[model samples]
Target: MKHEDEMRRRAGAESIAGGDEAEQLDQDTLIHELRTHQLELEMQNEELQRTELELIEARDRFTDLYDFAPVGYATVSDKGLITQANIMLAEMLGVDRNRLIGQRFSHFIMPQDYDAWYLLIVKLFRLNLRQQTELALKCEDGSICYAQLHCLPVCSAQSNAIRITFADISEYRRIEAEKRQYEEQCRSLFENMLDIYYKTDMDGRIEVVSPSCLAQTGYTQAELLGRRVTEFYIDPAQRDQLLSALLRKGKVNDYELILAHKNKAPRIASATCRLLRDEAGKPVAIEGVLRNITARKQVEEQLRLSETRYRALFEQTSDYVLVMEPRTDAAPVIVDANQAAFEKHGYAADDLIGKPITFIDTNISPEAVAERMRLLQSGDPVYFETKHTCSDGSTFWADAVARYVSIGDSNMIYSVERDATRRKQAEEDQARLLRENRALMRQLMQVQEDERRTLARDLHDELGQLLTGIQTRGEYITMHAIDSEVRIMGEEIVRSTSALFDASHASLLRLRPATLDALGLSAALTELTGERQKQADIVCSMRIDGDIDALDDMRAIAIYRLVQEGLTNAFRHGKADCVNVIIRKLPAHAGRDDQLWIEITDNGKGVHAEADRTPTGMGVIGMRERVHALGGTFMLTHVPEDGVRIEAMLPLDHSEDSGR
Candidate 1:
């Protein structure tokens, strides 16, 4: 300001000294213009200062946007060093921004992606245009991230660098991989599935056919595609019907149709279809799955025929066949009956259909029927005999076979019955005749025993007295003496008479045991056993329990004979070392009479030595007949250990007074 004042004063003096009024006016005007110019310069300076402050604010905003931007940004020098990196880029590489600057950017590139990154940089600088490439980027923690890099080359006064933007594309790549895998799976199913998949246009022309169509229809893809679908149908009209249904319902499930194969054989197929429509919702094509059901249909036909045949056999059989439902709480209820059953029972089918089985049964109780059914539950059949009453009140026996059958969900009893009346009647008649024969045999044996007793008595009365007299005379002769020769003759005669008397007495005892008539059955058995043991040189034992002596005379004699025959057989045929006899009387009880039990066992080689052990001999026959005649049972069986045992149970009828 002082220098300008000095310069103005000096210029003022010079203009005054020149003595020109016009020059002095020009100096004053010049001074006014100078001052206005200075004012304009000051205003411009203030405007510049305000513009500088606005520029600083804008720079701060831009820096904030760059640091916080979602995309990772970086600047790489031509040497591949990171000259600048945004906060996002630093975070992407898992490094601090301060540590990221001036670092080799290639270090963050994955080993496998190094070449790609190098090529990308080369291409960016070579073209000097925006370039993009995908790379796998590695973080400091060794984790991988997929990124697409968009790079642009930048030139500055100091050096050249590449500006790059990183986009994370890991999720996009993962979705692409999953889509490819899903397509492959769909392709595999279409090619390898057993059922046929197909598509047809509105004109019934085949459009798409899966590979399985060839195996199911006997037509290759070339022959089937672009062909009319109805041409394969046995009845072309059926295709129209199916299409109409599909259009109306939007879908059809499990529709059956017959189609002609390439070889002219008929094929059964089950189809499930949907109507495929255009954007306007108008039906344009049909898509469906077709499954070959020829084998299944054939099996069903065979089963139907088999069932028909079984029904025929079940109805036409001669034997009475009936099916019944068994119940635990009641008798079995009849479910069905064949023609024979209806006729035999003299009832119409309607009458017996819902009736209990006991309706026709005469003697079988419901409990017994239930028991038989229970036994049949083991999956085995049961055979039984029962009597049934006819409509006329006459009963007849039936031989029945029953089986438990499970059909579907029902438990039933199937029974076949045949008339067994005649057979049972014959068995009864034979049994009665046998009883009569045994009665006659008992009478004959009684007669024989009486004659033997009479003979024994006669022998004891007349012959015994004569034998005694002869023995007495012999003694007298031995006591007296005469001439020597006469005396010798007398001694010889005495010896002979004594021997003859002894012989007569032995014969009498053999004919009839006097002990039996005098001492009762117990003493009789003892004497008989003793004599047999002494004669046979064998061991013999007898056990008589209860009051056997209380038996009637006839039964007592029978008991004696039984023991006698048993011992004789043991010695003669059994070749036994020992014989055992047991006899006991059983007291009367409910449904049974007073009885005698006799058992004869021997330790001898069994009757198997003589072939079968059946009682074919007369002695054995006599024993059985006597027991049976007295309404008893007889068994002659081989013992476990090389012996035969005879067991007899005889009912006693006491016609005489008890001797107990």
Candidate 2:
């Protein structure tokens, strides 16, 4: 019971104490503290929101810079995994930005670059330093791009990441390609000289040429570019022939041909053609070189013509032409001889071609032969005569000539022998005949002059005496008769006789024309024209056109006779006519008077067809000879309608002067 009472008392005390503790907490202001704590929490939340907003703005800026940078930027983990990639890097790799993240870096490397990349990664990790490498990256499109990459290794106690940057190398590759191509062109240009060069399009056309081609073909590059090779060749078919040869043997040799150009001048060329081939070994075009052989061809032609002419002259000479070799003694040997030699010496060419000259002449002096051989060797000409023996053992005189000649680039002697036997005989015979002919001509001229003198004496001396007797007798009879009628009759008879004698004297004078000597030729010509005009009852005049000082007496005489004869012809044959005679001094030569011209023209019935139709008529022949003998010209023509013209130009101061 006491224990129970104590426990209860203790319980009552504890309850009072607990109540005091609670009163103390209440007294310490519990609501105020709770409110203060709430206010503090609200303020902290507002400050946290403001800090979050600032962080968001800064993160956005960083993302923009990383994705859009000019060069690619990426973050890789130490395990060769790409943890972050910017937009540029993703594009370079041909992938989405998000897709490239968390990808193994080795997966993006080309197979060719994988080993090199492994080495680079090892260096980056071991040294923990910056590293660079050129890598070919395989993109998602299955294309490769070269890249220069720089990696910054960021290593820490807790993190594994490498910061890497990449640069595209497209422009660098382009420049490198250009440099290599230039070097290749220079090498080809140097090594390919002395050969034909060419370029072709996809078609089998030659599109470019070298300067050597122009020199070879004589055509410009522009001329040949569009033209086929066949067009310029003399033979168009040669192109196909060359093609066939190339297809069979893969090349053609330096073949000879006469080729014609577009202008048609023939050229000789040595040609070598080769195939221009493609990668497939098919021939796409042809390339060739041509060497000009025109000058060589010209030389060959000249040599041929020279050979032909000389051979013909040597073989067919009427003189005994021979080709001889010089001998040490006796005589030079005749290697060849012509037909004339055979006829001259009575030996065939076959007998002489290889024989020494002494074979034809047994008495030829060895000294003479030796001298001739020396002269031939010294390049001098040799000519002499020697007695030659015939096949019949008969001897004849022969003349021989030899000279040094060049044949086929070797000095040689050419020899010729002429048979002077027949020529000498003919010359002797001609001298005898000429002497006889001169004697006969002299006798004939003497006879002709004697006959002319006798006839003139008969006409003047004989007939003049007879006519004088008749005139004196008639006058005597007129005086003796006394009756008027008888005397008148006698006077009539005297007058008649006087008229007859006068007519006879005129006739005798006309036969020789005595007045031709006393009067000058021009004066005589004037008298003749007046008489013709009176006798023919035609109107006529004589006129001289130029100075007559150039006329010699003979030419002057010929002119007079020509006018007189022409007018007589006009009166006799050409009826119903008028006449004109003209004389002039013709153009001169060597400061001397040249020709004296006489032109006698008449308006008459003109020359008959019988007279002029034949070029050689009697009158015309005489006139032409008179002019031609003086080395002058004579021309005769019938004027178209009513007249004839006889023109004679006689050289003055000719031998026909002085009555010769």
TM-score, cand. 1:
0.61
Q: lDDT for each of the candidates?
A: 0.84, 0.71
Per-residue lDDT tens digits of candidate 1, residues 1-660? 565677678777778776688667768876886687678878989999999989998998888778878888888999989988889877877889999899898888889988988888888778888999999888888888788888999977888999988888878888888989989999999999899999999898999999998888889999998999889999998998998899789999999999999999999999999998889999898999999999999999999999899789888999889899987788889999988898888889888899988999858876787688788898898999889887777888989999999889889999999999998999898876776676676778778778979998998899878877876776677678666776677788778877877676656655678998899889989988998898899999988889988777767877787787778777777788899999988888997778899999998876544533234334777677766656678898876566779898877854311221
Checking candidate 1 for backbone clashes, the offending pairs are none
- Model 2: per-residue lDDT, tens digit, 439-492? 454344346434644675687788778767876876777899887788788788
Best by lDDT: 1
* CA deviation > 4 Å runs, candidate 2: 1-250, 253-469, 479-492, 545-553, 590-593, 609-618, 655-660
Instruction: State the lDDT at 161 in candidate 1.
Output: 94
